[model samples]
Target: MLLLKWSAMGDVVIATALFEDIAQAFPGREIHLNTLPVWEGLFVEDSRFSSVFAVDLRARQGQMQRIVEWLQRVRAGHYDLVIDLQCNDRSRLLLSLLWLVGCHIPYRLGNRRQFPYNIAPAELPKPVHTMTRCRAALEAGGISATTPRPVLSLPQFNHARVDRLMKAHELREGHYAVFMPGCNAKGYLKRWGAARYAALANRFHEDGLVRIVLIGGADEVDECQAIAETCGEWLVNLCGQTEIFDIPLLCQPARLIVANDTGGAHLASVSTTPMLVICGPTDPRRVKPLGDNVVTLQADLPCINCYRKTCSHHSCMSMLTPDRVWQRVQKLVQEAA
Candidate 1:
């Protein structure tokens, strides 16, 4: 069996629930996951997956050549079943190419009713959440995905790395807050302003919730840096220092995690730690982090959930005040306690 979940960190994290579902459905069967190279380390040590295959098909240079080579490898494996959890054009093309190469896998499953997929859900309603769509895809293949939630078990090396970070900062488990205040360049509208985050950090600081940690990828370094500067010594800016695999492990010990509608929030959702995700341009119904421990805050503006990459007014996020978010954060933290 081969499960495909490619690029975009948030979508991959949400699809992890199907990993266990497939593993349970077919006991003793070889289960392999194909994802981007950066995400390969996440499932390397996972017991449910027999192996993790990574290929960067996004690189325009030699992309076709890479696809041909990857297809050859797939054909050689002769996998009995191939599940397209990605359900995108790339995976669809891969499936189509598999047929073109005379590599006929018995079961080709996908979400939408289209070519190359012999099986799919009868009705995958419009504007559905990513997790729900992934679950419905798996269930359509006669697999039960009842327990739909993100789950991650990090390797010892990853845990040790986090231990060193916690010790170096003189931090204890469940005694600190993590703030993810940035998104990628294309999704800048999703950010809830660093100024508002600084104010929220000040609120947390005033309440004696010291040891606020700010984390993000290279794209988010400047945003996190600004927050750290405004909050002073209390904020530990670890932007660009942590790996994708380090997110869940780091969140496991945190008191709470506050993030924009970004991948970090989705990655942190697997942890039991309480989290709050601020949603603006994106629709929470379709993209919010999934878990009982996770909460999403969206402004009550008429233009909320516009799903627009660019906006003239930007009232959805600008109108969502820090004080309003802080109240919900306090309620969540207290409830978790």
Candidate 2:
């Protein structure tokens, strides 16, 4: 079987429940996943997947040749089945090309559409969480996706890596809180502003409680740095220092994880750690991180969940003040105690 999830989508990346459902249904069958080259390391080490094909969609050297070669490889495999978790235009194009080349995959599933997958398209209702949608797709194939949450397999190497990162940052297990304030370029509007983050850090600092660790990608370094500057001794900016794989492992000991509607929160959700996801323009029902411990706080506003990448007025996020979020945090802390 071939499973194609060939993008750097964070939400899709953390959809572990769907993977579990497929694994359960297939049982002992070999599961081959196609993903981007950068994400190959994530699944290649796992025992659940038999093979990982790192497809490079952004081939600069031999673009057309690469596609032909990849398609030829697909033809050679003569896959009896295809599970398209990607469910995007690109995947559709590739699948159509393969069909044109006479690669007949009798069984195809995932996504709600019928073109690529004409047989038993998933009939899930709207206003559902990401896991629910993924589960419905698998359930159509007689797969039980009762497992609501996702999990990651941390290798022995990550233990040492975690130790190195933790030690370097003078962090103790379960003694700190992770603050993911910054988001990707695509989600610039999702940010709740640096001033707000600084103010929140100050509030926590005033109480003299858990240490604050601000983390993000290199793109977020400057933004996180601005917040850390105002935070002084209260916050430690480790935005550019950490890797994607490091987040789930590091979140194991977190007292709390407060994140924007980014992948970081989703990564942290798998753990028992308490997380508060700040939903601005994104719909909580559609993409809220999956876990009992994970809670989402969307502002009660008229224009909430606008689903726009850019907003003229980011009142959805800014309207919900840090004080309101702080109250939720205090309640979570009390409950944890």
Candidate 3:
């Protein structure tokens, strides 16, 4: 079986959850995954996959020659089945190219094509979690999904690396809370203000119940600094300090994580950390992290879950006050304890 999904880190993580179901359902079948070059490291130690193909879609630069070359390489594999989890025009085009090459797989599973393709489309349930949706698609293709949680096993992460990070950050052992204050480029409004995060961090710090570690990408450095300024000496800014692959390991020591609707939030959920996800335009029901200990705080605004790209008035997140999130944090901390 060949699985095609590339880029957008969180979505890839969500898709990984269906691997166990696919493996169990097709025991002898070899599962090869096609993903972006950057994510190759993330799946290096994942035993669920037989091999990983790192496709450099960006470098192809819309060149027909490069596309054909890559397509030829993929067609050479003679896959028994092709599962298009990405479910976009590019993926559909690739599937079409595969069909043109006479690599006739008994089944080709993907979203309903907006245009047309050789294989019939499988319609997935709407407004459901992407992970669950992917699992459902696998089920449609005869795979039974058992593990609902996203699977991420990294053998490269050793205690020495963990200890080094801890020592570098002066992180104390025990129950700590992580504060993630940034989203990816798309979901800016989902993030709470730095002051609000600072207030929450101060509350946890003053209570001496939880140490707050701030994590985010380089774009979030300003927000991280702003929170640190208001948080005084209690906060540790790990934003831009660690690589994307290092985040799961960094979050391993934390008991609970408070984050925006971001990749880190999803990572925190898969790390066995109790998580409180602050959401805005995105619906908590649709995209919130899937785990027993995961909770979400969203304003009861009528316009919430709109999935808008830009909002002139972000009252949805603005109204989700720090106190409300603090209450949720308190609950999660208690549950963790």
Candidate 3 wrong stretches, greater than 4 Å: 58-60, 111-125, 157-159, 335-337
What is each predicted model's overall lDDT from 0 to 1?
0.86, 0.78, 0.76
lDDT of 2 by residue, 273-337 (tens): 88888888888887778877778888888888888877787988887788999899888867876
* Residue 250 Cα positional deviation in candidate 1, in Å, after optimal superposition: 2.0
Which predicted model would earn the best lDDT? 1
Which model, 2 or 3, shows the larger lDDT? 2
Taking the tens digit of each residue's C-alpha lDDT, what string does model 1 give over 1-337?
Answer: 8899986878888888778788889999998888998788778778988788888888889988989878987887889999999888988998999998899999999988888999898776678887888788888888999664687767788788998998898777867899999999788999998999999989988888768888899899889888888887877889999977788888888999999999989888888899999999888989888788998988888888777889898888888798998899989999988
User: Candidate 1 or 3, higher TM-score?
Assistant: 1
Candidates sorted by lDDT, best first: 1, 2, 3
Q: What is the lDDT of residue 60 in candidate 3?
A: 44
Off by over 4 Å in 2: 58-63, 118-122, 333-337
lDDT of 3 by residue, 1-337 (tens): 7888885777777776766667777778888988988888878888888899876776747668667766876787788778878777788877777677786676687656443233333665577666666666666656676775667775565445767877866786655678899887666787888888888888878877446888999778888999988876557788888766567677767866888988877766667777888988888777887677788888888898998989888899789778888888778878877
Pairs in clash, predicted candidate 2: 216-239
